[model samples]
Structure formats: C-alpha cells, structure tokens
Target chain A: MMAVAADVPGAFERLVEAYEPRVKAAVARSINDRSSVEDLSQEIFLRLYRARQRYRPTARFETFLYRVIFNACVNFTQYMARRRALSLDRALDDDERGNALEPADPGMARPLENIEEQERAVMVRAAIDTLPEAQRRALLLSRYEGLGYEAIGQIMGLSLQAVKSLLWRARDNVRKALIPKLGEGPDA
Target chain B: MPDHERIGDGPVLSEAQEQQLLAYLDDRLSPDERSGVDAWLARDADLRRLLDEHRRTWELLGELPVPDEASPGAGFRENTVQRAHREERLRQRGARRRAMGVLAAAALVMALVLVLRDRPEPWARLTPEERHIVQNLELLENFDLLQQFETELDLAADVEALQAFEGELTETLR
Candidate 1:
C-alpha cells in the first residue's frame, strides 16, 4: 500500500489495471449518465494520483479509493442536476433516462428469458436510482460492494447509526418500489 | 395503520423494530441482539414477513446489471497513465518556477545588504572638524603646493622684507 502511494505513477497504472472494472462499475452505478462513466472513472483515478502524497496509511486503500469515488459521483450528480435545471433539453425520454443499465447477456439465457430479465434489471436500476443519493450510495456500497457499515460510513462520511438508518431506509424504499412491479417473492 | 405495516392481520413492527430486523438481516446485530431478534421473529409473523421482504429486495438488487467489463475500453489504462504523467510534469514545472522565484528574491535581498553594509555614514554623523575640512576642501587640495613654499622660504623674514619693500614702494609713489 505504501509502495502504491510512494510510486504513484507506476503503482497507479497497476492499480488502474487491477481496479478499472470496479471503478467503472461504481461510477456507472452511482451516476445516471452511461456515456460519462469512463470519463468519471478517469477523473477518479486522476484525483487519487494527485492526492497520493497525502495518502495516509491509516485506512485501507480501498476505503480511501471509494471515498474519492463517492465524492466525485456526488459532485458530478450535483453538476448534472444543475445542468438539467438550466438546460432546455430536460425532456429526456424514458429510454434515455434508463440508459445506464444494459440488457442481460443474450447468451446467458433464452430470448424471452433475456427480455424479461432485462426488464427486471431496468426496474431494479430505476428503483435504485429513485433513492435519495446518500441512501443509494449506502445501499450500493453495502449490497453491491459488500462493504461493512463502518466502511460505508467512512466512504459516505456518515456516522455508524446514520449508515444503518440510510441502509434501512434504502432497503425499505427499494422494496416498496420493486414489490409493485416484481411482486413479493423469491427471485423470478 | 398504514397498509405497509399490516401483514395478514398481525401487529405492526415499530420503526425501531424494523431497523432491528434490517440489522439482523445484514448480520450486523450483536449476538445478544441477534438472539433477541431471533426470539421476536420466532413469535411474530409480521416481523418475519418484513424481514423476508427486506431480504428479497436486497436480492433483487442483483438484477441491476453489472456494467460491461469492456465499457472502459482498451486504452483506458494507457490514457489515464499518460494523463497522470502530464499532470505530474506540470506540477514539477510549477515547483521549479516557484523555487527560481524564491532564489531570485533572495539574491536581490543579499545584494541590497552588501550595498548597505559598505555604505558611508550620513553627513549629519560627521564631527565638526571633519565638517570644517570638508568645507575647505579646495585649500586642502592645494596643501601640497603650500607645503613646498613653506619648506623653501623663512616665513618671518619674508613678512619683514615684504613690509620693508612696501614702505619703500609707498615713499617713491608719494
């Protein structure tokens, strides 16, 4: 870890090589813009590189990396919101709004199965998107990334209790949103 | 009672109880708290149902598609590295410029100190005798000639002879 911090450029390449997929996925999950995922992921890496000198070894590197990702996502979301408010091009259609989630792989299932799975995926993505930003972040970090509550709190800058509250609210909100479409049962 | 809190005519779980159920589902509760929740779940069908709903919702999150691994493109790693290199160069250039600026400023200060250190004192600081010599600077400059004359002649005899010559010149003129 110290080596990664010390030799930022070299080690950062390795880090990017290793963690690019995770970073891309995290950014894609956090923001609604599918097109900006790569750009945002790049920006996150650049931020980490710039801050290498100040990278204290106090916390796990992954936690620190996620913190940077979380901050960038938050800033980007706010910027997009402001842009959306001011721009006359706000009349985004449903397809454009739900562009972040790709359809499930066709080879993985039959055609009908793939379409149904894709629809469910879109619904789930939309439900996750509908959550408040903090709750969404908490939920993604917990459920998707499998981070502990303390780590999620550190990444989101929330207290432990606040993390719990956000997760609970996030889960409850997603449940309410999904139940109407997917219904109350095991995975279909 | 809200419809969400209702489960087949069973009693509702309070907000705290629901939070506890969530913690239990996540396995975040302490052993004792887990035991407490276990006892509650064993007795309360509504609580158990709520837990199941939360768990299923969490499970449904799996449906949110993982971003395609190829989405970042092949050049992403190289592009990011090149960009970082560019930034590091800019940062180093800035540091060098700042260091040169500091060195230039220090050199200017040193030059000023040397000039001031060897500088003459103010006129007001001169003694009265020194001021007098300064006022008679032309005479002092001619002192070498005056010294030659003083060494060549007897001053008192020259004065008496000049007086005698003056008396004779005055009588002739009269």
Candidate 2:
C-alpha cells in the first residue's frame, strides 16, 4: 500500500493483483446488484488510486482498504436506491433488477441439491440485506472476511463495543429470520 | 438483578452479555474473559442454547456463495493501471494550468508596476496655463523689482531714469 501510495501509476498494478480478491468479495457481499460488481470494483480501484496520496502507513492497509470499500458500497447502494425510487419502471425484485443469485455450482451433478443450496443462499442474503447498513457491513466484515472487532470498528468508524453490539444484533436478527425456515435442528 | 441473569421468559441475556458471547465466539476475548464465558455457558443451559444459535447463524453465512468470480476479471490490473495513469496525467495537467494562470497573473501585476514606476508625473504633462506659469516663475518671484516703474508710460516719460534704473537693476542682478 505504501509503495502504491508513493507511485500510484507505477506501483498500483501490484496492489490490485494482491488485493483484488478481497476487494471483489467485499463489493460482491455488500451490494445486491451483482451486475454492478465489476463496474463498482473498477470504480473502487480508481478511488483507491485517486486517494493514494492520503494513505498513511500508521493504519493497517486492509483497514484502510475496507474503509474505502465500505464507503463506496454505501454510496453505491444509496445511489441505486434513489435511482430506483425515481424510475417509473423499476423492477419488483432483485432478480428483475438483474441481480439474481447464481447457483454455487451451475454444472454440479446434483441439480436438486444445488438449487436448494442456491435458495438457502438467497434467503440468507436477503436476511443480511434486511439488516441496517451498519449492522450488515459489520456482519460481513466480521463473519465473511474474518476481521477482528477492532479492525471492523476502524473500518466502520465505530467503537469496539459498538462493533460488538452491531455484530450481535446482526447475528441475532439473521438467526431469528432463518430459524423458521431452517428449523432449530442441531446443525441450524 | 441484571436482565442477563434470568432465563426462559423474555430475552435471556442483556445486550452486554450477548456482546460478550459474540466476542467469545469470535475469539476476541482474553483468556480470562473466555474462561468466564465458558463457565457461564457450562452452567447455564439457556446461555449455551443462545450461543449455539448464534454460532449456527454465523456459520449459515457461509452458505452465501463465495463469489466464484472473485477476480475483477481479465485486464483489470492493466485497465486500472492505465486509468490511474490517465487520471494522474489529467491531474498534473490541471496543476500545470493552474501554475501558468498564477504566473500570468503575477506577470501582469509586475508589468503594471513597471509601467507605473517609470511613468511621468501628472504635473509634468502640463496644460497650457501651467506651462505659462512655469515660464514666468522667475518673474513671479521678483515682481517687486518692477515696482520702480508705475507703468510703461512712466518709463518712456523719463528715458534717462529708465536707463539709470536698468543699469542699477543689471548691477543688482549681477
């Protein structure tokens, strides 16, 4: 990150190569509009490039990166929401909006199992989406990316306790939402 | 009693206790904290159940497919680098343009100062009346010397007196 910051044009490709997976995953999980993931990812990299000079090594690089990703996702979500609100011909569902959840494995031998898994994935995603923005982000960062509470706090600009609270609420909410469909089985 | 101590009627744990459980689950707690939570979990059936539920819910998040297309795709690196370079060039160009603007403004100010510094004073570019006053400046200063003659007629009336007065005046002037 420091190298990229020093000479963004020259050293940025290395940074991109290193962090692209995490960046894409962050964007993918944050927004429901999967179609825009590529575009949003590109935009995020551009923003990172533009903001290279402001990077300070005092903070963790992933912390800084996640912060940028969080802000971008938020802005993109808000923009999409407003666009949807303004458009007379808006889609009724995410599927119609061209963000249908793809099956985990399209060519799997067990089509039934794949479809069920895809449905569960969609349900879980929808549950996640129902959470407030902060809770959702906190959940994603903590659960998916496996970031610690302090890092999550830094990324979200929350206190450690606040992050803990968000994560708890996020998990509780998802649990409540899923329990009816999934049942209180040992695995569930 | 704090709300977290009770079980089975409403929310089993207070928010703080729930947060602690979450921290424990995430392995964020210190060993002592973890031990305390573990002891509580071992003793309390409700707390254990809640922990299990939270754990399962967290695990359920794994079902959300790790985007197989995690890569930003082919040419992403090259594209991003090219775009960054393009933006950098544009920014540098903008900076250069701004510098040129500032230099142009400074040059204009300097030119104005030079023009003003070597400029003739307002009085030096005299009007006709001012020119006349300047031409007769010495005469104006010595008007009392002319008092010897009442008029030109008197000077003509006593030509010898005028000639003597002129010689005296020349001697005084010398």
Candidate 3:
C-alpha cells in the first residue's frame, strides 16, 4: 500500500500507468522462461523507480523505458548463460531441467534422448536465443505485442522501414533454423 | 508492368519491395501496390512460403502466455501511482532546495553589502599620517575636490615619498 516514490520530473504514476504492460511485455518478449519474467519485470520497475528523480525526457518515455528494460534483460541473459544459477526459491514447476535439452551430434556416437520433441523445443528456443537483440525485439514487438511496424519503431526508436527489415531478418533466421530441425534440411 | 519484371537479380527484394510488403501486411499500402504484391505472392511460391512462415510464427507466439506479475492486491496502476507521487514529491523537494539555495546566496550577498556599508570606509581605516599625506598629495595633484582643508605640516620629500606609497597601493589594488 506504500506509494512508490521517485525523484524525477514526471510522476511515477504516469509512467506506471502508461508503461506497466509495455515493460512486462518487453520482459516476456526478451526471455523464454516464464518463471523469471515477473521477477525481471519487478526488477525493471525497481530500476525505473530508482531512476525517476533523474529521469529526463531525453527520448520518448516508451523508448527510455524500453532501453532500461532491454539493458536489464541483457544482463539477466548474460547471467543465465554464464553462471546458470537456478533460483531455488522460485515457485515454477521444475517439470523439465533447463539443460537436459542440449543437442548432441550422432557423430559423437552418443545415445539420443527419449524425448526428441522436448529436445527440439529446447533447440528451437536456443536458436531464438542466439538471435541478435534488435532482431529479437523487432520480432517480439511485431508478433507478440501485436504492434504495428510504426509502433514497434517508436518503442525501439527505429524507422518503420528498418523495423521491417530487422523483422524479416529475424524471420529468415527462424525459418532457417526450423527447416533444418523439421527435417527439411540439406543433410536430410 | 514494373521495370523489375525481369527475374535475375537473384530474386532479391529491394528495400522498396520489403517496405511495400510491410505496408501491405499492416494495410498501409495503396491498392495498386497491394494488388501487385498479392499477384507477386501468387506467382512466387517461395515468397508465399516465407509469408506463411511469418504468419505461423506469430500464431505460435500468440499461444505463449504472458507472465503474470506477482504482487499484493495493489496492482500495477496503484503501484505506478504511488511511484508517481513519490517522484513528484522528490522533484518538488529538489526545486524547493534549489530555490532556497538561490535565496540564501542572494541574502548572503545583500548581508555582506549591508555590513560593509555600516563599517568604516576603506579610506577611513588609514593612519592619520597616511590621511594627511593623501590630503596634501591630492591638493597638489589638482584632484577635482573643490573643498579644501588647509594643512601646513609637510616637507616636499614627504609628498614625494607618499606618491611612491600611493603608486604601490594603486598597483596592489589593481
């Protein structure tokens, strides 16, 4: 019930009212793990609150918010990729292990896992994860947020044309990845 | 009917074509362009395949549920409002602090001037010897003072010596 406090020119209420979903959407779009999304979303707002007093309208409020959220997501991704530390206290169903899905080559002569579907799911996610941040964001904003190209451009501070190009590149990569995995590759 | 009708730029889409396709998808293009792309899509199965891929991707992405934020009953709007109030307070306080600082600085300057005005003048602080020398020296130098206080006490050497001291004092002040 405690009112949030910030030290900026604009009201935190204005930012919160206008941008809560945008921030949450950004977090969800950036990360694949549902478990970490809410925490990351809270962390994004916490950073926003901390910056409120000094927050200048250097760009559109949405653009600024996206920048902050994007930075936090990048940091989280780096931490996950490196330390790979699992949050023991989180309540997500631990139905599947995070790394039980690393792809193995038959050339290595190892036995294939029983659940190839789960393995493919993991592989597909890994391919998406390897995409450049800009491409990923463009794809997510266009596809997931259901934003028009102009809106996506505003959020990402790109031109509409550039947003489309980026989205296309992302789609091309996704297609290339899916085709190989779906048994339509050259080797197959 | 377009100049790009010949197909061997490796079938690459230009920046213009890509922009057109995007506009077509978002329903921002002209009818002519839409029909053109629609015809092109029908003619080029590869391009159609790519379109289907983008379309299906979004469909799959749509099925992925958005994560629910965990907080007490105070939802996002309330939390944001609270944050805004806190921010507004901080900004107001900062502005007030700046205003107070400017007032303090102005008051300091004014206080200093008042104190200086009430105190003895810089010239008044001089020794009588210096004062007398100044009075005679000014009289001889043809200073514009029409009011004269007569004094018989001085050698010409004292005037010369005071002139040297005056020169040094003027340099120091400068």
What's the true lDDT of residue A160 in model 2? 85
True contacts kept of each: 0.62, 0.77, 0.31
List model 2 lDDT by residue over A115-181, tens digit each: 8887788778878888988889999998888788889999888998898888888888888887677
lDDT of 2 by residue, B98-122 (tens): 9999999999999999999999997
Summarize candidate 3's per-residue lDDT along B19-93 as a digit string, tens digits.
676677667778898898899887776566656665555444454434343232247566645654576589789
Cα-based lDDT at residue B4, candidate 1:
37
Q: DockQ numbers for every candidate?
A: 0.34, 0.45, 0.16
> Given candidate 2, what's the lDDT at residue A78?
95
lDDT of 1: 0.80
Q: Could you tell me the TM-score of candidate 2?
A: 0.78
On the 0 to 100 scale, the lDDT of residue B69 in model 1 is 37
Clashing pairs in 1: none
List, residue by residue over A72-109, the lDDT tens digit for candidate 3. 88789788756544543231234344433333222211
TM-scores of all predicted structures: 0.75, 0.78, 0.57
Candidate 3 chain B: 10-residue stretch with minimal lDDT: B144-153
Off by over 4 Å in 1: A89-113, A184-188, B1-12, B69-72, B122-174
In order, candidate lDDTs are 0.80, 0.80, 0.64
Q: What is the interface RMSD of each candidate, in Å?
A: 2.2, 1.6, 4.7
